[model samples]
Target chain A: MEFGFSEDQTLLQQTVRDFLEKECTPDAVRSLWERETGRSPELWGKLSEIGLPALMVPEVYGGLGLDERDMVLVLEETGRFALAEPIVTTAVVAAPLLGRLIDTEHSAFAASWLERIASGDALVAVAPEGQPLIADAHVAYLLLLSHGDRLYAAEPDHVQLTAQPANDQSQRLFTVNWDSQKALCLASGNEGRSLQAELLDRGAFGCAAQLLGVTDRLIEMGALYASQRKQFGVAVGSFQAVKHRLANAKVDLEYGRSIIHRSAHSVSTNSPSRSVDVSMAKSFIGEAARFAAGESLQVHGAIGYTYEQDLHIWMKRAWSLDLAFGSGAWHRARIGDALTEGGLSAPHFGFEPRGL
Target chain B: MDLTYTAEQQAFRAEARSWLEASVPKQPLASFDTPEGFEAHREWEKKLHAGGFAMVPWPTEYGGRGADLLEWLIFEEEYYRAGAPGRVNQNGIFLLGPTIMEYGTPEQKARFLPKMASSEEVWAQGWSEPNAGSDMAAIQTTAIRDGDDYVINGQKTWASRGAYAHWLFGLFRTDPESSRHKGLTFVLVPMNTPGITVRPIEKINGKKAFAEVFFDDARVPVANRLGDEGAGWSVAMATAGFERGLMLRSPARFQSTARRLVELYRATLAQGGFVDAGLRNRVTQCWIRAEAYALNTYQTVSRLLAGGKIGAEASLNKIFWSELDIEMHTVALALLESRGELLPSAPAAGDVGDWLEGYIFALAGPIYAGTNEIQRNIIAERILGLPRK
Candidate 1:
């Protein structure tokens, strides 16, 4: 197996890293946090125009159709800047969900919608929370997974919304009421379940990759702050306690990144054992991000606690997504379950997410 | 880009696993923590050697299977899966064998390698001194020039199996006037040589895994010198590379241990209900970390199969896996609660208290080979290209 990144993926990562660093800074993150909408529509359009959402879409559908590592690079860069965008939610998650839909009975509708989403022509926000038909926020589409069949997608307008205060000021959560009339059934029966599971696995990979970025950036920021900020006439970083903490954080970051790379490879190849891997990645990286972010805040002391500083942006970003899909604890249980089951089920490729 | 094994590799794995399943000893060793344990395990090694499962990468003349690395990795994974005993002569076969293959005189290979593969002699490492753990370059174990031989008069600590080793191979200073590295020479000395003394160190676990050796004019023939007289530094480094990097403890060993830990955890949980949240959390963490290391090792092997060099980053794998072993055993102990404090002789014993015993053995992990702190420094300065401290 080739562990090295493909030349194209390497170039793509470099390009996206440059784009995010140039276009979005901590100030940009702050501006987005202050806004009620939390995301930048104008910047979203630019990313869409540049085919940011289409990297994983097949070339036949007028998209780049790159692999999971490419998306990992994009999400990683997006996370580095703490970009307040749902490229992860829209491009990596919803768009791919729609891509799966196109291969099923809903091809006609999914095809047009996917093409529009791939280009900058259309927009789709993830279902805020609650259920598919119960979103509290307005969006072009609501993504939901049902137990028996495919994901039932409903328009936000058709669902009754209930608002809840989110942990991060930049992001809000919503609960929705189900309305089959307004929903488009993406995948059903075995296909639907299979599609949703695969998508979640992929999304878990994306989340882990994003967390690696978050942890790496926070570690760098914390180390720099410790070295530059002096306490008692010496650099705080010089203290053994601080150094050990940073060292531990660095170890956590490396371990987290290693799992992400492995999980990405597993998903890309349709390895049947991807669940155990994804669970391991999500659980390990989830804690690593939490630890790194918490230690960063501690190292920075009082200023880091204040909303004015940029560290909380990353802290909130990690916390929000970490709890959204599943917390570290949840993944840990999954790992335990997999281990107790003797081993994980081997991953099967080419089979639709539905059915065995 | 495919990480999956080929059909041939898969078949080879099945074959190895089946053979090991039939051949591996059913009874666990009397002790995995002593020199006697090493000797006891040596019989198992001999059985494997006779079965053609030993030294898979070496040539047929050397009593090897003449297989490639993928086959070797498959064999290793399956060996662990089958719960085979640890290779008692690992130092001789893993490190010295490869070094001799590359840099030894033909006579040296003929004399040493076959005996090593066949377990006729067990080898011990004599590199670290009391003053030189992380700073191995500062070794003060001197080997003064003598007529037709080198008279060594220094001490080495933390020598694995040295107390019962048949022979020892490592660096000794031959030119005190030269730089620390330049004055050194790698030599093989029979443990039975005159003026040699070995004192086994009873560790916190009460097992003697290491020893301290004293040489009061211990003479090793000039013919036993490896490579050149003054080129010992590089030769020792090659052996250390194998010891610390490739197939040292074998990935399969850790994989099997991890698998067993998971099984043991589940069984304990079944026999008893949830003892505490903290212990459960730790158990889960250990299992996952171990699995991650297994994957990391596979990636390392795959890289080698694809003709890539294993860089210093490989140190991270050892650091990760060893620490995980410690953590897993720690969790296992806390789960046992008061029962964990009991001796092996106590009634209502659990799993021979191997986990508890292993927990104690694992305490030396960061202190041996190289400290975890030193490993991090290597990663930071060498792999990450950070500036030196």
Candidate 2:
């Protein structure tokens, strides 16, 4: 049996890689990062032209109907560039979650939002981690917000223009305000928290996958820098210290990949470990990004820390994403609390499937 | 992408389940935690071979079903599900069999495969030496060419299953002057050869499950050689790959065990004292990890079915479940609390001590079969394109 991606999948990946290399290059990303726009609207249309925005949407709804794996591949490539795209929020998160929430035969609100999302006209913005969120933003057709017992999405009346400078600073963040009439209840009470938790878990898993891709690129950047940037009459990469750090980075990448694999597999199977896998992966990879990025910067020496260098872009994203959902320490604490309360099953080989 | 088994596979699984249900012994089989216990387990293995349920991975020519990896996985799942005895001839059938299939002379296959399948000749691996655990290239086991035979001399440590194993398949420095990895040759030597000696090492659990074997002029026929000289490393890798990949443990077995763990948890919780909120949270977490492990196995199986080679990423699966094994046992002990101190044979303790025993056994999960540290090294160097340290 083959575990490699299918020929079609390969082509899809290659196409996206090529597109990002040619159209959404590092320079393009830097340009947007400088502008402080969360997305490239023109590029957004171009992505729609290439049909990425519709990959998860059903053909009947003017979309690609691609599977979750395919969507993940796209997101991963997007992350490699650290692209200023809301695909994760709009396509993967809001669309799918909204798809599930829609009471098909009769819900006008759901149908209208689905049509807008499918047509690639509407964009969704998720709340920054640890923020008190208002479910109404001017441009967003639907804003997902959760409180103790409720999840709401509605129209905004007098949205605030206050700047909420996010860690990624590149992605635009705004503090929003809205009245009760604009808040359409997605779910009443604690069910909303469960829904939000599930969505957050998916988001965490996706972010981990993206971070893994970024880590791979960071390692490559370090390798290239080490090869070219000479010191002591030889390429810096020739040093054992540099080599070992890169090697450890490689180990982190592999570990992160395995964790992501476990998380993805759990999500696909609706396994009980879905949350745990997601938590472990988010925790592990968050730390991995920090290490890999720092090592990569060190490998590149002084140039890496400069704003002019593309390396800082990755470092910024890495730091930003590390703290995005929950930091590594946060997830670690969750796991630690669980282990202290209940004995860990398969603690060392947590996800290895053997004869149980 | 489909993880579901075929109709033929389903039928095979059904037949296997029924056979196991009808034939499984009432009492627990001898454990592999000790060398003596392993020998006791071998007798149970003979019963398996007599019934033709052992060695399903071997081809039909050797009296097996000529099954593929999928069937082998299924067979292993059923073996563990039935609470079957530990594989006494695992080294012979799992490691050596596959290596022989790829590189053995026809005469060698014909001579050894059937006997190996039937448990007539159990085997142990002789790869790691005291100085060459991770760096197998540094092996010092010498096999000097002699008239019609090889005179072998050196020591092999941590040769798993060696205490009662009948034979050994290993690499030797056939050309000492040659470069480290270039001088090796794979060979099979009888465990009880005149010049051979074995001493079992007791583990923390007071069980002797692995041994250190020494050889002094252990004359073995050239016919026992596997593949050509200088090609021992590749052959050994192929053997180790199978051991680590599919044979050491199958996903189905783990899936069943996970289910059983849940059952055990439910039973333990039924006692009420253990049902605190913290315990409940942990139980849920363990349930999640177990489920994730099972799904990952399914994904691996699906990949295999889709015609992919299980490569370095197979180590990913290995790392995942090995950690899980430790976690599972640790959880079991926490469930037992103070009773976790009991020895397996203690009169006051029943199976409660098995959890503590398993907890100790779990410590080795990441150590042997290539330490998780080494696995991470491989992942970085090979899988992740990281620089070699």
Candidate 3:
């Protein structure tokens, strides 16, 4: 019962992280934040050149044919750098959703988009579940929209987007104004509803993975700053008060990380508990990331509160992602509902398989 | 990464479950803090030893099944699921047993481990003293050498199970001139030695779960020393790692508690009681934390199997599980409301479950096994490389 990443997976994640270290530096993130569109085609191209967008696309569609487990770490690298492009929304979430459409009548449409996504020629923005805003909608060539039991695929000309600036300006969120009749229906009824559920789980899983990375960065920054920024005749890190704050945050990050990895496995295997598992991951990691951001800022004193500090990039991303896909409270409530319905058993806790 | 148990592991689990199902006491045993309860638990341990399930990961020569960490975890899950009694020799099997395997001489292993596995000699930890609680290195207990024996003097407080334990293991300053951690020695002492006294300390729950041990020129053989005289600090740290890490507090224990808490929540709802959204959320959050703890332990075990050592990062596991234990109990008590205060002996207390007793015991989780505060300091300093100053 090995519960660890494979050497190949670790190497793949490291390769992405090394690339981001050079290409998606804090300066690059800040530069994108200042842009009118808050988007960087060059950075996206470089990410695609490394096969980031094709990680989850099936090999039959000129992609890598990997799953969520393979993409979780790469998504985390995107979050560690606070990459301006919607890599998670497009590559991790939308690409896989489009790939799943191969079995439906919309196979041709999905294949064309998948091929474009694999080739780095197209960007797809998936609307956050139950949220009116869609990130990177303006930059995306295609938009995957869900309405009740119907899922639609819309091109740029079929939908209108009004830019809605977020606290994390690097994320180009927009309120999409689109008509379902103008878009092509990908799936409907039971299939559409199931796909929608899968989309939410995948999105939440991706966000949880990213939050793990963001929390790790925040703690590292806090520790580094506390060590270098001295007060009271010594490094503030020498004080138990400051040290313990970051220490507690690190504890939260460690546990939340395991939950995210477990959720990745659940999503990859299409486990029956995938929805609840994703909720658990999102809720726990979301709270952990938020705590890390706050504590890191506290440790940095007034400097962290300033706009010039790079810590804000991760802090703002934490805030944005915490509320994206599904808020912690929303996911907690979903878990509460499941617990009440299922009456709390071994299966719920992943001890024994349930309907597998 | 694969998370499924192997066919052999599954078979092991099935065997353990069946054995525990048939062998576990139909009714809960009395608290091991008392004499009769201690004897009962000792008997239970013998039964477990006879079944070769006493220490799943220990070698066959030491009364174990020679299983891996994963099977041990599976055995723990079955043990808890079957409502088995708590281990009366945890201080021996979990902490010192592993330390012995790591540092003990061949003769020491032959003399100590088999008995420890069978609870023939229940062990109590003698780490903390009145003046050296969190600062354990401040231990003043001296074991001055004379001929072939060491005369032990000074006191050790908060020694878990000391009241009825057959033996006690602790660190003592071997060099009279040495201070703090230097020149210390890890020693095992028989409780029946002359000039030794054990005065039981009552816990907040009014049970003698621990004791203060005093020694005045009590002589112990040099053979009882677990490691080199000046290297006791490192040896003790290894034991602390095991205590704070995976062995002492397995996730299945809390997972079982979480399952019970969920049952309580369900029962509360079925009683037409007022259950608020916040309380429901807390219940679900507790379950999630338990699951997360289990997953984290699996990750750690996986790393260990792949030849990684558990270091200061064990501080992370200590803080997480200790707090999680308290949180689960707190939420369960909130669900019980006033009923939570009922003692097990109280009339109409059957539905109250073990929340009150469990809660009182759990409060000590963060206190013993290195206080959570101490764990945080370790994480910050050793792990994060924060300056100690």
Interface RMSD per candidate (angstroms) = 5.8, 6.6, 1.8
Better of 2 and 3 by lDDT: 3
Report the lDDT tens digits of candidate 3 across residue range B1-389: 88677778887888898999899999899999999999999999999999899999999998888988888888898899899999999999999999999999999999999999999999999999889999998989899999999999999999999999999999999998998889899999999999899999999878999999999999999999999978999999999999888899999998999889888888899998768888898898899999999999999999989998879999999999999999999998988888888887898787787898899899999999999999999999998889999
| True interface contacts reproduced, per candidate | 0.22, 0.07, 0.80
CAPRI quality level assigned to candidate 3 from its DockQ score: medium
Off by over 4 Å in 3: A343-347, A353-356
Cα lDDT for residue A29, model 1?
A: 73
lDDT tens per residue, model 2, B1-389: 33445777777777777887887778776676555666667677676777677776567788687766667667766676677766777788877887898899999999888888877788888889999987888999899999889999999998877877888889899997976778899998888778999998777766777889999888999898999977888888787777676666666555555555555666676666374555545554444444445555555655666765567765665666677777777766777777778876788676573567666767887888787766665654565454442
**lDDT per residue as tens, model 3, A119-199:** 898988887547798888888898889998888889999898888878887777889888999998888899889888987
TM-score of chain B of each: 0.92, 0.92, 0.99
User: Which candidate number maximizes TM-score?
Assistant: 3
> What DockQ does each candidate score versus the true complex, computed on alpha carbons?
0.26, 0.16, 0.71
Error of 2 at B167 (Å): 1.4
Which prediction has more favorable TM-score, 2 or 3? 3
Give per-candidate clash totals. Answer: 19, 34, 0
Q: Provide the TM-score, chain A, model 3.
A: 0.97
How many Å off is the CA of B306 in candidate 1? 4.0
Better of 1 and 3 by DockQ: 3
